[model samples]
Target: MSDIPQERRVLTAIPGPKSVELQARRTAAVAAGVGSTLPVFTARAGGGIIEDVDGNRLIDFGSGIAVTSVGASAEAVVRRASAQLADFTHTCFMVTPYEGYVEVCERLAELTPGDHAKKSALFNSGAEAVENAVKIARAYTKRTAVVVFDHGYHGRTNLTMALTAKNMPYKQGFGPFAPEVYRVPVAYGYRWPTGPENAGAEASAQAIDEITKQIGAENVAAIIIEPVLGEGGFIEPAKGFLPAIARFAKDNGIVFVADEIQSGFCRTGQWFACEDEGIVPDLITTAKGIAGGLPLSAVTGRAEIMDAAHSGGLGGTYGGNPVACAGALGAIETMRELDLNARARRIEEVMKGRLEEMRAKLPNGAVIGDVRGRGAMIAIELVKPGTKDPDAAATAALAKACHAEGLLVLTCGTYGNVLRFLPPLVIGEDLLNEGLDILERAFATL
Candidate 1:
């Protein structure tokens, strides 16, 4: 068990005096663009709670943006990483390779979806892994066009910014983006004009038509998408959507890449969301929860496709840091030992049930435009009562209310109208319900 208590406790105001001082110092030192959901600073965190400088124990619903699935300081991860740290922090895998890096790649090969011969290369962040995936795909297919979907967010890098769809915060004033990256419509069930039943096939058909017509299928190198959209509001693409896209990619020799950065590991009640549909992609990019809060990412794919790049063609100085690799191994071990996949499903059952009940109790059900997502990765789209139009203000207000009461929540979406929930997998049932109770109170305030 963790030393930190699994309960919400507020001391002083959220930022308190100490945190206020630190925020002042941060303002002077940090750039303006760097923003935080809370003004308070984290002193320590473990299990389901984050203790701030004020000694305010906030329930962690954000999981540091889905980066710490096993908890912020999981015992196994801390133990393994500490041992590796004492021995050596970094020998630079490119200069002098290490067993830890090789072992992590081997694990990725085994864990990532697919039984085919596979290979993997590591990177320090999801964006880097994505950039490398595109590189490998182009090298293998000998083509340049890359297809991405509407409302998907890959990363902040120049190349990924082109792949992303949202404009205001992610893409405004950040162009000209990488070329030949085409955007297609994804299966958004709630907003589907023709209805959710037809969303899968119709969205896939529309995407395929756009790719084949605008960017010739033969010219396309890869079609990269998130099986469950992340920063684009936890939208699970409609059923049959992934399979149709995968079939098109296979037939046209275009590499299919699943960006499972946010939805991978046990966050989505599966090791990888792609497994839900059994749609194996030619390449998959992983990060976030892979290293138990450590910065590490990987591009795992078929042997032939991965090996397409020439020897010495792919690598980075800190691609697979030894300590990060140890942390990843520990995370995988913990997942198996605790069966986090099962825990995630239980969380889904409990939380979704409560959320649905909350919706039913509301005077006007349209306050929650949609409640969707799988397992621990759930979200609610807020809207004006009795209307489908987005209520971004209500979303912001609800998140603010949660934060004020020692419940840390996060908001996201293409239109800034989603309140995403990404609690650590190890959160206890009672604590989880208490957090939901706090959320219901926040909703009531709204």
Candidate 2:
């Protein structure tokens, strides 16, 4: 498979024959409320490309929303998963415990940042991990309020929706959110009202101060944040801001939770983004790429904090599915043996080089307002030239053009004006360059 030629061949138009048939069937059989990114239907996928039902090969930069860090159809991942399935499919960890589940938890203890004794509980999705984290925080701190930053996306569940910032799609008619949830401004340098050039410390300090004043730090159970904002435009918090928040949370007895669902597992160069600042979060939530596309999420934290919840309160029927545990174990081994953290840095080097070049050339390029993110988790925010106003229309146009040209990309942001790149860390340089070229051409059209 490695020797197979890597080429993009459009045998038919994007929604060609089979895809049109499927789309028609989908309209009838699937929910009318379903949303789609591209009309193209996927038939197969390998290293860095997804083959549509029309047989069109397109470079993939979304990675199933960053759940396949080792690439779709990874050899080791497939092998391990296949072996696990051969042994047994499900015993329901709660009903019958397994060694693989325990092994995966042990690995989490070792890998997740912190030298302190840690404990972990697995779940089926990032939201579950987040919800569990909240439960643990409440139990430990005996507080009711959970504070989240603006533009932060925790999940779509009732409690998480309250924690999430976006209103339109996520929380539009789903109102009357969970109680005791407080919102604060994030350190988004691009549109920060205070100004971008200044150190974000002032804005962060102000946010902390306001939260403390309004809710009283003692009443806060936890302060959850994504180290590099995920759906919030992949914005990395400014220097000193994260550390300051960490210190504040510690001093106030607030559980500092780092939601690394989209930034973990070498996606941000470091195993975890908080490691960049050397800040130790009281609890860390992980999912997405953790189990190589299998559904698994975990909350790892200080043993004492984790122990706050009763044993019966934590376990879920399918929390640590054995197959997912096996897949996670294999995924971790693959990352270690293949050195995907270093690979992520290499990808950043290639992508940054191309993006910086694009930034330098185009005049309308002010659409590329900011290019930031650590390692393979990168994004470019689109904006009206010389202003912080979001160019959401331009972002949609660029994404449409790229899709038409056989390149898959994803857009994210509070304003829906940013293009985020989450290609598998194993993507080849040639494929990466090809995707970048497609993006360049798309920008040219814009």
- lDDT of candidates 1 onward, in order: 0.93, 0.89
TM-score for all models, in order of appearance:
0.99, 0.97
lDDT string, candidate 1, 1-446, tens digits: 35987878998887789999999999999999888989989989999999998899999999999998999999999999999999999999889999999999899889988899999999999999999999999999999999999989999999999999999888899799998899999999999999889999999999999998888999999999999999999999999999999999999999999999999999999999999999898999999999999999999999999999998889999999999999999999999999999999999999899999999997755699889999999999998887789999999998988888888999999989999999999998988999999999988877
In candidate 1, stretches whose alpha carbon ends up further than 4 angstroms from where it belongs are none
| Predicted model with the maximum lDDT | 1
Residues 128-233, candidate 2, lDDT per residue (tens digit)? 9999999999999999999999889999889999999989788898888889999987778877676665547876788898887999998999999999999988
Point to the candidate with the largest TM-score: 1
Provide the lowest-lDDT 10-residue window in model 2: 1-10
